[model samples]
Target: MPRPAEAALLSTSLIPTDNSTYEALPLVDSESLQALITHEALNASALELFAIANASVKEYGHPTRVIGSGGHYKTLGWIEKQLKNMSDYYTYEKQEFKALNGMVFNHSLSVNGVKVLDEKPFQLTPAAHVYWADLVVIDNLGCEDIDYAPLNASLSTNTVALIKRGECPFGNKSSLAGKWGASAALIYDPESDEIITGTLGTPTNTTVGTLGISKTLAESLIAQKNAGVPLKINMFIAAYVGFIKTKNIIATTIHGDQDNIVALGAHSDSVEAGPGINDDGSGTISLLNVAAQLTNFKINNAVRFAWWAAEEEGLLGSNFYAYNLTALENSKIRLFMDYDMMASPNFEYQVYNGSNELNPPGSEELKQLYIDYYESKGLPWVLIPFDGRSDYVGFIETGIPAGGIAAGAEGKNSQNGEVLDKCYHALCDDVTNLNWDAFLTNTQLIAHSVATYANSLEGFPLREPPKVASSADVPYKFNLHGNFYIM
Candidate 1:
């Protein structure tokens, strides 16, 4: 069982943020490392993870673990307690940062005085209160600046800009609307009736507020504009945009080669929907289970396990950590492995591409490790682009070679042709959203992969001197928002 929050304070009791504390455990022979991970142990860990998650919902009176919320703080406590109780082999630190978070108190939209579905506000956007406004439709996929060139949007400051969700960040579309002098940007899913949710990457990315709507409503507005009818909307959104204090819990083994670190991370916060069980409860627990089991043996390279916050808002926690690292500090980490959504209900073994263009170098080798592991077990695995969908965005843009695994969320299940996790970012993504068989399998992979590198980085290339790249250089795959999707 997870301990109470008060006891979790011990996780804050050790290690300096600058990588100081070091205690060495005798390194075990590389050949005997396989015995470190056991199925019984993994099953036990899974139960603990689910219990902690479900219990938080009951204790906090809300399912979401969004930043600064009770549920989010509770998960941080659980993570701390889990690591601090692990035989004193770990020394932990709380890396603090200022997280920019936005909240929508209430939002609703109406067209021609007819009620419609409430528009969900994207994170980090300003509030909106428009009594009335004419509608302007962005005709093409507003990905690039040129796409918005032909748009005949209104010049009035009171006009509403409507655009379709297409090959770009919703922020880019909204930002374009801000350029054309619109009061608000309304993005709609031209392909699906289901409404969407997202973040604008950072605070004040646009002057006007951004909200999402559905195809049925959007098409009606477009048709009205195409015809000779006037379209006006009354939209109201009460929101707050500001910074919040949050911390990342990074626990390092007290014993091992501190120079060549094997860092593994998963974001600790969730979307404003559901308990986030499969989206990241699985990812969080995978690290916990592996961290605990690995203590049975010794490691050659030090292992670091991190719980990142504000990943839903953008990769805030990990980005802060990566950005603040000195060049020398960046070189110590030989590999970075991110675990996210390890147990999607409709599961597939998806490994991020080692050859992913976003990866710095030595990433392809990391990709092959998972591929080889899966092939050896006769498990079918597919390739996914190492997009900026998760916390790895921080490590890679910092020029650290990184790779990891995911069970997938929005992608279609090859067999049935359905969304991988139908409850993705929805209120239904609870403990029951997990596929146990797949969970166990991936948990084993997490343990095996971590232990393999910890024992020795035999072929895992040493990280090159980081030639840091700008954030724009990284191809962050949009369709992004929350945890499983892009940003």
Candidate 2:
């Protein structure tokens, strides 16, 4: 990392002067921007900017930032609360958190529509493991899983073996059944009527779809067969994992027009991979710097600075905010600007190519604004696709004009690529992974855009206000998924 004094001096010296081509406002002064990034570097380590973050988790067991886990949300909440306490000029709104609880497996067993087993929330089978088959009780008791001899060649093709959960692990039983050509395996609790959930632990060459049924259900099926009553049963299983309680920290200036808002966002949560300091801490810190500095001046249009949650999980936080907005609320958003990886170690300034076909109206003009700013500063920049891969996806899909910048990620790390960010999403993506020079320059660009739009949206387009659906019209209550990589 660069020395704080040097970084501050270098940052301050590059503050762009007002040009005749575009009218600029001093919403954030040069001195404050320098101080903010300097403060940023000084406080980096204390921020716990690394993977296996929580000492408590490490002391107790392995440290991993699993989505919706205690360590993950707790760290994020603390950071947002600290930022919330930083200023009084901006009003804060913490979006309600949502978490993706364990999957609710819906399954059933029906004998010619007699409904032998009713559909209910069951345990999650392994992902991509779905099946329907006739039940076959291999009452081998202590040796059902190990003794495949009980399941002979005469068994039906749709066979689903029923075994007691005792002698061996769940994976062993499922493996045995799968080897015998059984379509699925039903593992039941030996002592109670309660259904038990189990995992296959890891991938295996032959692992069948597995479910847990109660002792009562297993016995009843056994009795029917003992009574010489021929039974034909059906089974169904499915699983989904998403939407946990995570928040978006939104702080808007109280001095500007709420009707014409200039929104700036950076995702707060990091991936399960690492603390994501350069991948996003750089962007988050940049926004915080600008937000803190902007308190010194007022604006004509509202500047809403947002630190979105669950961005690592597919832009869910931003998507939830945009999806729930009414038409009037959508129209109030003049534009949205996103800041993702602005300080990649091996960096290249990437401006979103809003001139492309993916984005809605007004994106090209926003793209041009960035192009002009970089050109005026004599900086080298390249255009990246506007492919709805970032938080801007939600805003653009809803007709809110959006633009932003990025410093390359994993995909842009090769000889043929414009730039290479080798530390993209790994544990190495810490504070040291950021190039301070690129960090300061991109942050200044963000400050310029924020100030320009907050002061006035003079050159931007004016079209019919956005048409957002009513609350009842949206199919899902929230949009949640995770896997969009940094550009």
TM-score per candidate, chains pooled: 0.86, 0.61
All models: lDDT?
A: 0.74, 0.63
Off by over 4 Å in 2: 1-52, 55-66, 101-243, 356-358, 413-419, 469-487
Candidate 1: deviation at residue 435, Å?
1.4
Q: What is the overall TM-score of model 1 with all chains considered together?
A: 0.86
**lDDT by residue (tens digit), candidate 1, 372-487:** 98899899999987656778876777778889999988768887888898888777787778888778778788877787888778866667676454545543323443332542
Strongest candidate by TM-score: 1
Pick out the ten consecutive residues of candidate 1 with the lowest summed lDDT: 1-10
Q: What value does the lDDT take at residue 318 in candidate 1? A: 83
Distance from true location, Cα of 206 in model 2, Å: 16
Q: How many residue pairs clash (N, CA or C atoms closer than 3 angstroms) in each of the candidate models, in the order given?
A: 4, 11
Best by lDDT: 1
Q: How would you encode candidate 2's per-residue C-alpha lDDT over 1-487 as one tens digit per residue?
A: 1112211101011222433312243454443444444545524532564442453244224332334555556656555555555444566777665644333234565654576552222222443333345567765652454466556643567777777766555666777777877776777876756454433323245666666667887788788867977666566655544445556777776667888888999877665445567767777777877776676665778889888876665566787777666787788888889999888877877898885344556778889888987898798888976766678877876777788998887555444654466655554566567787888888877878787887788878764467453434432122311232332
Q: After aligning candidate 2 to the native by TM-score, how far in Å is the CA of 352 from where it should be?
A: 0.8
